[model samples]
Target: MSTVAANAPGAAGGGLEDVAASEASLRRFLHGLPGVDAVGLEARAATLGTRSIKTTAKAYAIDLAISMIDLTTLEGADTHGKVRALCTKGRNPDPTDPSAPRVAAICVYPDMVATAKAALAGTDIQVASVATAFPAGRVALPVKLADTADAVAAGADEIDMVIDRGAFLSGRYLDVFNEIVAVKQACRRADGTAAHLKVIFETGELQTYDNVRRASWLGMLAGADFIKTSTGKVAVNATPPVTLLMLEAVRDFRQQTGVQIGVKPAGGIKTTKDAMKYLVMVNETLGDDWLSPHWFRFGASSLLNDLLMQRQKLTTGRYSGPDYVTVD
Candidate 1:
């Protein structure tokens, strides 16, 4: 089977419709993917999670992990003040120590993009917004497009949109594919640049490893810059086995298509230990090419605080008290 790929950076998405010209063809391609080996996958993920690093390398991994975080706040009560504070923290993760790295982006609702952008003006930190009726993704295509356009207009460097899992689970693969293509279109800016697109699969709801693998391909073919694991609101999000499966998908997709996409495992990744395991999985599965913040991220809020605490432990040779880091 011929593989489909998105265009280069600054290009939103194109030339993928023919690959899924019909529901049958799309279904054929998705279902044709190699089935996942559940037991082997889980065991490997467990083994990778047990990897250890020396004290010096552990500091590097902790810093790298800190830099790859998508500092996020997606609550209904989010305000401009909260968003600004989040941006400040993202720009300077550790206030007392200047060595802490800045997070990749400040993730918030569409309305908070400008505030975040303004707060992080001098920094390279991207402002990412969740659109297309995030977490549920139950809106119509037009509404979803408008939602995406609003974020792009609001100065979001990245748009994290959710796939309509209902359509995907119903075998309406073409509908989901078309929606992603359309959302990619909506991510374009007037200056000919584009906000990077990240497609969220909310894996816990998919019910099987096979579905996760299928969704990963569908999103990439539709031109996602990143294939994300969850909305972080689910009962389960960003587990090691599921993340390993996604890492494998991107690895295979790139080998065939020659275009690299990113992966983000969001939610429930609070501890530095959990973050390190995911980092090890990325390194071992996809290698160092995907190790940077450009390709991998932890969709976390509290995880940064933990990384800060661990960082302090490494530098001071003693654990910081719970009150050491600000509770965001």
Candidate 2:
């Protein structure tokens, strides 16, 4: 856990007093965030993406990326059987190597939290669920909170909630902010310990770098332990540049607030090369503090297979094929 109190709305030196004060105050704080220069941001991400990592460093990063994956299966056709298999995959990504590290968590829809919890019990892996009308935050606040509470009650370690982009883009910034606060509260378990809250911005719908930046701040101020890039249901999800911008948000948020929030870029990232680029971006932008699974995550399902293949190639002198890795 971070030093910043998750429930402390206005802790001294937390840099959240003004943001939590009022809707008007929040608007000012968000608007005051520096505007993003699109071209420059893209250039920086591209430059970092071009970094060449080989041999030992590449092997370490492959394992690190595997550990950072939140192996997900969020389909409407999801079943307990499929979730159980996915849980197995998350626990033992490479049967060929017992030394292979397990994934950080198994991400599924709210209803599958119990199934995943049962399947992944007695392991270090966590169970994360998507709530708040996931992919589309178009539901009543009560319903959303109930969805979140259900997941927590079912033993979810993390709750990924979607913000009302309709409310946010329509200038109802306080509504969006308060909704996040409410959902964060809903993540609390009966034991008083709460599931980590990851607020999804759905940046593709937000449409501008400036809006992404503002939404990042909005989520952090609203007490999200992590601010995710997308729900992965959007037309465009986790681009390198967007992920770069979010990394910047977390970095700046920590610098100002002393709160160490995490960043997860979901949806489109695939391939060991793609994961490496993101690692490079984090290594350069946020330094090593954000390098762990505690502070960064790659929300991917197929990306894990590629990472496993890369790991196998590193272990053996020969390249491995998809048939070698388990299919889940």
Encode model 2's per-residue lDDT on 145-169: one tens digit a residue: 9999999999889999999999999
1-328: candidate 1 lDDT, tens digit per residue:
0011334432322333456768888898889899999999999999998998769999999999988999999999999999998988888888899988989889999988989889989888988999999989887889999999999999998999999989999999988988888888898899887888999999999999999999998888888889999999999998999999999999988787677889999989999999999999999999999889989999999999988988998999998877787778
Q: Count of backbone clashes for each model?
A: 0, 0
TM-score of each: 0.95, 0.96
State the TM-score for model 2.
0.96
RMSD of 2: 1.8
Off by over 4 Å in 2: 1-15
Which candidate number maximizes TM-score?
Answer: 2
Error of 1 at 120 (Å): 0.7
